[model samples]
Target chain A: MDQRKDDANWSPPRQHLEIGDSPADFNTGRVQGRRLTGPQQGFGQLWQKTYKVAIPNRTPEQIIATWKAEYGRFWPSNSRFYAPVTGIKPGEVGLIKSNQGPVPLSTGVLVLYSDDTSFSYMTPEGHPFAGFITFSAYEDEAAGTIAQVQLLIRTNDPLYEAGMIAFGSRAENKMWEHTLRSLADYLGSSAPVDTSIVRVDRKRLWKNFRNIRYNGALPWVRKVRSS
Target chain B: MPESRIAMSVRAPKDTVRVIDIAGELTAFGEGVLTEAYEDADRPGVKSVLLNFEKLDYMNSGGIGLLVTTLIRAQRKGQSLGAYGLSDHYREIFSLTRLDEAIGIYDDEASALATT
Candidate 1:
């Protein structure tokens, strides 16, 4: 059967991420069975960030194809994205190893949706931000093909919220900027990335303060200090 | 291809639950319609709001986020919410995202509407 015809770009369902019996890596098995967390479930104020680059001669489909194929390659080098064995199709889990200032963090994301022109990922429990980041491309009559990444996120816990206020925000901004710049460079352009941030909600959800229990930094701190 | 358009209508069915009927695709750009519909339905004395996905054919992950956001807001406002008419695919999506744990999922309209 042609899965594309039946599913129409949507992902199938899985109760939990089945990490199976893979050899131990940094944090592959941690997020294996954890549930996905969205921005609303987080404790901090909500934010929507957009990073975009204008691709002069490319079509939206072309840009999206390249973005999906080389998604991990466009990262900022220091971070690692382990694409799932089945690739970035919807419902697959991708492991991530990144840092916040001097702290090494490990987490993963679920490929929630994937289509020709766009794909979105949902962060798992214990991730710094409970959120969704969408990568997409579209034809803008004025700007040709617009390759963009949009993030709607909220700090997953009080500790992560404090980190964001310190240096995490800047580090995150640079990371995505680097990604967009790399994508533009990959497509044979050097256009400066455009970034915009919006505070979608100013009030924090104090009710979610307990989310600190899943903070990845605690385990990371313990692991690093012991070694 | 034509851009997807989202349309929503809110009406009380059986003089009980307020049903919000959603149609067309739920994408990032189409979120405003869902928001507006929820706003209109979330009035004083409305005990529960049921989202009718019968006419909703396509919804991406962003749309699921939008639904989750709306559910959070509605619950915060003390208005209980439920949904019906999701195909098995979407039902699984809800399960995968753990949205099934957050929102009540029903098989069809009759069973959903028949409930309190």
Candidate 2:
């Protein structure tokens, strides 16, 4: 077997993320010791949300290059993604600061794979969703060049599921829609972003109800511990 | 660097399980075809799905994410999921993502088909 194939396509095995020093405010031990969580480990029904925008006349490679460099700048205003100084690359961790209420929720994602046309991030424990998000650009026969963000996720815990049922899903859709719109604007296209959502699973994994213990905000610590 | 493509075919050699064989590399480009095949394979009275990855030479992160979503879709339809013929490396990939815990990983089609 050619080992280079695996080396080129997969992130090196790591139990936990090692976040380097950066000017980012949210990276202070927030991601340390947190196990990476996939959708199977989450408590809510699974969802796959795909957001795409067509940026005509540009090659997929060029779009990906710009997307990687300007990743944080394309996010919605309410959430701030603090990319590492070295920028998005395989095996790096990026901190994300978002608000649930008065408390700021600090979480991070591991750069699980990076290549010329695509990169993916795996969430750490306590993130709103447990899963991997892949960002990529590809050429569609009719669309010319399409930049897409696909999220395969489930709410991380019972509390998170409750929150999602109340508001998180809409907020998440709007957030990514804003992001695709921003990316389209950056790429000089006024095309409306396309959003497709699929409810991948309707059954909740009750076993992961205990994941609330890892809640990353001050507001949830006592609430989770008491119950 | 061979061009990536996943040729999928679904069959039912047993009453309760549907076996989907996926060959070639699975990446961003391979998802739509797989999704279509998965949806087409859905049938009443099938209690489980056995994904045969024996001919799959490569799977990137996008492919892994696609698999997770596929698993979720299967679960939603009340079908148990299992996989067979994953290379050792891909098996590790499943373990790292804890997807192996969600679905059984088997050594062969017969074993996976026999799974209860």
Predicted model with the maximum TM-score:
2
Prediction RMSDs, each to the true structure: 3.8, 3.6
Give the poorly placed runs of model 2, Cα more than 4 Å off: A1-6, A22-24, A218-227, B1-4, B39-45, B110-116
True interface contacts reproduced, per candidate = 0.32, 0.45
Q: In model 1, where do residues sit more than 4 Å from their true spots?
A: A1-8, A20-25, A189-192, A201-210, A219-227, B14-17, B42-44, B109-116
The candidate that achieves the highest lDDT relative to the unseen native structure: 2
DockQ of each: 0.34, 0.40
Error of 2 at A5 (Å): 2.9
lDDT of 1 by residue, A95-187 (tens): 888754677777788888888888988887788888789998877777777888988899999888998989888888999999999999999
Say which candidate scores most in DockQ: 2
Chain A TM-score, prediction 2: 0.91
